[model samples]
Target: MENKKELRNWLNKMELAHPLVIAGPCSAETEEQVLNIAHQLKDTDATVLRAGIWKPRTRPGNFEGVGALGLKWLQRAKNETGMLITTEVASPTHVDLAQKHDVDIFWIGARTTVSPFIVQEIAEALRGTDKPVLIKNPVNPDLALWLGAVERFYEAGVSNLGVIHRGFSTYEKTRYRNNPEWQIPIDLQNRFPDLPLILDPSHIAGRRDIIFDLCQTALDLNYDGLMIETHNDPDNAWSDAAQQITPETLDQITVDLRIRKEEGDAVEFRNKLATLRTKIDVVDHKLLEILGKRMKISDEIGKLKKDNNVAILQTRRWNEILGKMILEGEEQNLSEEFVLRIYKAIHQESINHQKKVISN
Candidate 1:
């Protein structure tokens, strides 16, 4: 994985006029159902049809996918519509089965990506594969784990690679079904600009209403493509019905979503952009300087607490600071979520500093 840029070779080979759209039902319910959705999406922006033949649900007795039988339906759909087909492969057996069915592409699910052993098994199973394989981010927000999964596949000599950002699981209640920690994917994209980055907004939104917004955000950030779960009858879909949209809705969403330019063309635009970026750099520098000062103050406080034989953690004070910061953050047009994440990181760093002082 030394040259992550090579991951884009498969995508570049396609030379698609529009962003790659992989759309289909969450699970392949039946041959008729699969073909019905495929025919509908065939006219849309969707370049690929995706389905789950063996869904590994969080719990049992919840329609654990149609198994290998569903692959037949996806094959039929591909034969009829001539669209590229993809499916999730959790194990080596799945890899063999999907290859047998001639699945055009393969994706590793979030749950599978969480486990190194499973990823290794699948990667070995897919060794020397010429077809594209997409790796989804892990269920939790662990970028290292996600990268490790990708590297495993790469090490196994599967160079045709891409990644899906399907958001991350969080206990906190929010409008989203999963927390869209945008920075994680952004960081990945920053480090490996050529690595294909696709966003699975269906899982992130968990409802049809906000899928458009999420897709728009991804396109605005220059995502390579999107994977949306779409069904002919979304409300009555067998699995993940809440997140599934109708093919018509998916078509409209693609039409409505805006894709912004990555860079300016005109000199005037470039000058303005450069000026704005300079201001951001200056602000970022100031923020780091302020953090340095804050850490110094934290070190002094840690020394005083050590001399007084007091514990490093002051839960009540931390809560009060967080509450006040949230209110002040609102006035500055900073979200409570942003304030919370920033302060939490700072607090952890302060604790680390205090720990060092206590140890000495």
Candidate 2:
């Protein structure tokens, strides 16, 4: 691991065509898939090719991954194309294998990022190695946990540190598969001003159609790179079909992307970002207080509805609230659509509380 000064100097000297892309399939499904994409992307500016060798899926009986054998295929891709290679390392053994195979970069996935024990183990494995390691945010939106994982990697002596802002898992139904809380990564950059940050549009959008827009938005926010999933046949991909793009699609996206400068000194921009975040913190606290009051009122409503044996789904009341809130949001320059979505969630929770009260 590089110390902060060493890492900054390395990033500065890399001469990356701002917004360096690092793309490949979600998993190296086969050698053919890896090679085909590698051939297609050979002339492109992607600094590293990423693929999942050990996919940790939630359910059993699904396509877990090709395992350690896939590492050989990645090495082959690097040998054939002369491009750098990267893969996710979930365990100390994974670290050992990747190091043994001369894998250029290793990323800690969101699933592994959530567990301090796993992060520490991986860190320990990487203690003597100088491999460039990227840490993705945790599956949930826990900033402290994410930072801790990065700090661990740094403590372990890995200097080429970076972060992949792949969005966060949430219960809300969003157009995005993962909520692109752009603010979270921005907050990260504010604290670690020298840290390189990349965006994983594939995981965040979770649909090919939205990857372009997400990439554009990440660029607008001055992210350092993109880690998109590109497969030869997205529709027939073995895993995450909706999120995978064809190599042709990724090629088009690269052509279409516009990289932006940070507008000013990186540190200055981060300080400004911090000021905006401080404002968000104040507003968020007030919003939570209001939500607490609203829940209290909801409890009262629940008691009344239970006493009257009324069903929790009061369509008329919901319609009124939605209408009023939408109008109010528009007046305040908030996206009416966004406000409606938030209120709908709050309303659903209120209904759930009422139902529970009625049942008990």
Candidate 3:
């Protein structure tokens, strides 16, 4: 594995004053469409132009990209617009073809990242290359699998690595099409601090209106860049129409988003932040202490239950606790979702404690 300093060479080489922007249509609909968007984006902050050539769709007969023909379109767009071109590569054939077409960057889609066999194959195909390969997080929110994909590339001697947080697949319907489990990428950031992290708000929002907000949030979280799907006409785009935005809208968005400084400029601000963080540390310590005491109480309750041969899980009690805590959380300015998540984990831990005692 490349050390931290060696891993960050690509980013250092860019020396961009602003975040790197990668923008283009989701899929190359036509030569005209690709070139049109590319022309519009070339003037904007986007340094890299992207178009999906071989889209991995969930089902068949659903317009699975224009194939190799799209690569020529992307190449032509790059030439005309003077922008770096990128495309998603799924198989070894895709890799070989992308290299032939002089694709500047390669991105491993979420679907391809899921399978070790495919990732390894593509990694080996891209072995010892200096191109910045951006790997999207797997379809599911598995950090291990995502890191595994990065590992495969590193093992293949590909060092110019980065990641795209395109969100993840989930059954629950929410505002987002793909749930932006932000913590998963944050965890990856914790492990590989040098890896350039980019946000694909286009996939996460699945709507044009919320793209700017997502982009702003990403910048606030110290994301290195964004990969937004831009088309000449978003509503009538070939694929992922809901998520795609127009080139004009993208231009406005790039202008509107703010890039905050990582560190406070003033000594006053630094002192205030340090004091606040110290308070947080104290509160965190107290929270742990209280949770430890609660667990000890749970242990006593488990012993009592064991003597009477009582079941560990009391669904009625859990529901009551959940309902009550949710109401309390709302009073304390916490969301119901946050309360439910916290309480559910506590309830599970309590159940485990009881199970251990009862089994003994």
- Predictions in order: lDDT: 0.87, 0.83, 0.86
Report clash pairs, candidate 2: 1-157, 1-158, 1-159, 2-158, 2-159
**Number of clashes recorded per candidate:** 0, 5, 0
Estimated TM-score for each candidate: 0.75, 0.74, 0.75
| lDDT (tens digit, per residue) of candidate 2 on 96-197 | 898888898899999999999999999999986766788999999989999999999888877778899998998867677887676678788778877888
* CA-only RMSD, every prediction: 9.8, 8.2, 9.7
The weakest ten consecutive residues by lDDT in model 1 span: 1-10
lDDT of 3: 0.86
lDDT of each residue in 84-107, candidate 3, tens digit only: 899999999999999999999999
Candidates sorted on lDDT, descending: 1, 3, 2
Q: After superposition, how far is residue 142 of candidate 1 from its true place, in Å?
A: 0.4
State which candidate, 2 or 3, has the greater lDDT: 3
**Model 2, residue 340: what's the lDDT?**
82
Question: Which ranges of candidate 2 are over 4 A from the true structure?
Answer: 1-15, 262-360
